[model samples]
Target: MTTLPTSTQKKLGLVIDLDTCVGCHACVVSCKGWNTENYGAPLSDQDPYGAAPSGTFLNRVHSYEVQPDHGQAALVHFPKSCLHCEDAPCVTVCPTGASYKRVEDGIVLVNESDCIGCGLCAWACPYGAREMDAEEKVMKKCTLCVDRIYNENLPEVDRVPACVRTCPAGARHFGDFADPDSNVSVLTAERGGIELMPEQGTKPVNRYLPPRARDRTEDVDILAPFLDPIAAEPQGFMGWLDKALTAMPGGR
Candidate 1:
């Protein structure tokens, strides 16, 4: 008789708190550190110090200014990466059978040794989740730090993914999404969390809680740090430098 494997007791996943994110890059850096150290090859850089800089990363934080044409500007910083979809297109499209989902905990993984680097999985993803490792010649994306999460050798508090552990603002979380009582599930429910590109219907497991609204006029300066303002062309030494830089001496 044909029989499917029994699902595990938990479906592990992540829930991100946009309200608390503070747009810090700590999670990004932590992800880089962990993935580079453990994944087959480090996230490679192409022309890193040269023009047209690019690299492969499993996680990237995207800063967006979400202003409706008639409304106030709301800045949103999204950390983009694999959502590890339940109906992941990346899995089915893998001609080499490298991409797979674990029925045990629902975390998707790529078998790097088996990958042929066809990039079919990359095209199947609408979120642009997958990237090719130029050096390894294989597909790469988030593993959710699978080795760390289930490692019995680590301390209980450090068992989560590196990104979740290093987030200074407590913006990221890792837990069993199948358990409604789990922290991830509860937080998602409480915040009325949203999923990105839901229309694509990949059934992404990650959730993003929206940021709280700020009073446009009163709280605008709260965003000043991100804007990086400098003294506007003062009438002194700095002003001279600024004018020199802007006008370019030989220019008309």
Candidate 2:
């Protein structure tokens, strides 16, 4: 058996590469795909292929347009998920001990068998990490693909979580945060990473490295193609009428 490093006295975590993430939803899709099949259930959309659709996800990529005081606009993609905090409120607030942090690794998990379908854990989490599994009447969150990560049957290179493996831009990493010499540790040290919502004092193990300084000229050039005045205007009276209608309060 391949034993995990002894340095993992404390739980390990992930370090996301924000600079390299392309805002592709591949990680999200892969997460839904892997977890749905392996875990209790796949993330489900209430109205899939319909007018209004939404569902649960352990991972999600958020796109933000960051405008610096003296620089050009930057399109930043943030993949949000459970940081698997050292002082996880989700675990403490669980009245049924359903939400627990793993002793073997730092990964937090929900035991559906023990859960009472109470939403307290969801309310306690500031990051919106926990989602209700409506079908099972239990809270659901990321498992970090515990089954696959250490599976001896899988190839050595495929041991990482599905989200990390599907990241085309190479923005996701999984490793032991407890090990000072681990790859995630080394990357965070070199990149001067920052944690989200540090004020909450959950002591999240995951880190997000700030995006690199981008060139203003390049940013403007990227946005220039969609800004043509001629293209912005529509064809004929119907177009003008549409714009006028949109001008009405909350019409747009």
Best by TM-score: 2
Top candidate on lDDT is 2
lDDT per residue as tens, model 1, 1-252: 011124545678788887777778888888888888885668888898998988888988888888877677777888887897877878887777678888788777888888888899899899988899877788889999998988899999999999999988888989888899989899889889888789998888899988876655644567768888765658788778777887997744
* TM per prediction: 0.80, 0.81
Assess candidate 1 and give its lDDT: 0.82
Overall lDDT per candidate, in order of appearance: 0.82, 0.83
Cα shift from native, residue 158, model 2 (Å): 1.0
Cα lDDT, model 1, residue 109: 84
Candidate 1 residue pairs that clash:
none
Worst 10-residue stretch by lDDT in candidate 1? 1-10
Query: What TM-score does structure 2 among the candidates reach?
Result: 0.81
Per-residue accuracy of model 2 over 71-166 as CA lDDT, tens digit each: 568899999989988888888888877788877797888888888988998898899888997566778898988877988999998899999998
